[model samples]
Target: MIEMKEVHLIAKLADLQEVDYHNTLVLHALIELLVEKGLLTHEELTAKAHALDSQLSFQLDLASKLSETIQNRHTQIKPIS
Candidate 1:
């Protein structure tokens, strides 16, 4: 069972995901407009997309590592019997 403190964290994560989804839609519309106007090329968009993907990948890996470390540290601490 998730503890009360962890429940808030989970909720916050959900909220962030919701916000990101909305932002992504807005960005897609802007990108479409830019492409239609000749302000940006498809190649430029693809390169930017690749760069964002790499950044997100790195951040997720780092978050996973941090979470693992925190869990390990939590397990190592002896509880008062």
Candidate 2:
């Protein structure tokens, strides 16, 4: 059974776009939390964060290109929609 912390870590990793992955503020916080929860060792978490950061960079590049092609898009995110 996966722990909640592990589940959240994976989900957040997925949620992070490539550009924001390098945002030290974001990744560091996540890594720190994972470490605190014992879901990952400090070294392991740090290394994984770096790898994810690089992967996110590529994903961001692709998203940027695709964003331009998207028009009149409907956002699922809403406030009282």
Candidate 3:
């Protein structure tokens, strides 16, 4: 396993709290291990991460639009037929 010392340092520099800093170290270490073990090639990991990011961004955009629609719905004044 790659030494997580550098990752921890990075988390600290990024101003993550203690738990988050340590969790970042752990996450990096696990990813490194996965890459080293061939379970996830670097390219595969990169692609997967990018895909997830894109999906998450899309979900957030959809959620924002839905929320706006719902918020606006309450303000609509329907005319009597």
Candidate 4:
């Protein structure tokens, strides 16, 4: 038998999936419109996306390293009396 917690989790997952589907549809429509209007070509969009992805990845890595350093510093700190 499924537990109540399991049921709630399943419901949350379904909601997230629905939201993701709608967001994907909207993004696709916007991309198509931009391409159709000649505002941007597919190649340009792809290149920009790749550039942004790389930048974001670098930023995330830096953030993770900073977080780890903070954690280590906290562990090394002695509590003041």
Please give the ranking of all candidate structures by lDDT, highest first, separated by commas.
Answer: 4, 1, 3, 2
Cα deviation of 74 in candidate 2 (Å)? Answer: 18
How far is 33's C-alpha from truth in model 4 (Å)?
1.0
Point out the higher-scoring one by TM-score: 1 or 2. 1
Taking the tens digit of each residue's C-alpha lDDT, what string does model 2 give over 1-81? 999999999888887865576696787888788889999997886688799999999999999878855632536445685
lDDT of 4 by residue, 1-81 (tens): 999999999999999999999999999999999999999999999999999999999999999999999999999999999
What lDDT does the true structure give each of the candidates? 0.97, 0.81, 0.89, 1.00
* TM-score for each candidate, following the candidate numbering: 0.60, 0.34, 0.70, 0.93
Worst lDDT run of 10 residues, candidate 1, spans 1-10
Candidate 1, residues 7-76, lDDT tens digits: the string is 9999999999999999999999999999999999989989998999999999999999999999999999
Candidate with top lDDT is: 4
Sliding window of 10 residues with minimal summed lDDT for model 2 = 68-77
Model 4 ranges with Cα > 4 A deviation: none
Q: Candidate 3: where is the Cα deviation over 4 Å?
A: 1-16, 77-81
Q: Which candidate is the best by TM-score?
A: 4
Total residue pair clashes for candidate 1: 0
Instruction: Give the TM-score (vs. native) of candidate 1.
Output: 0.60
- Residue 7, candidate 3: Cα error in Å is 28
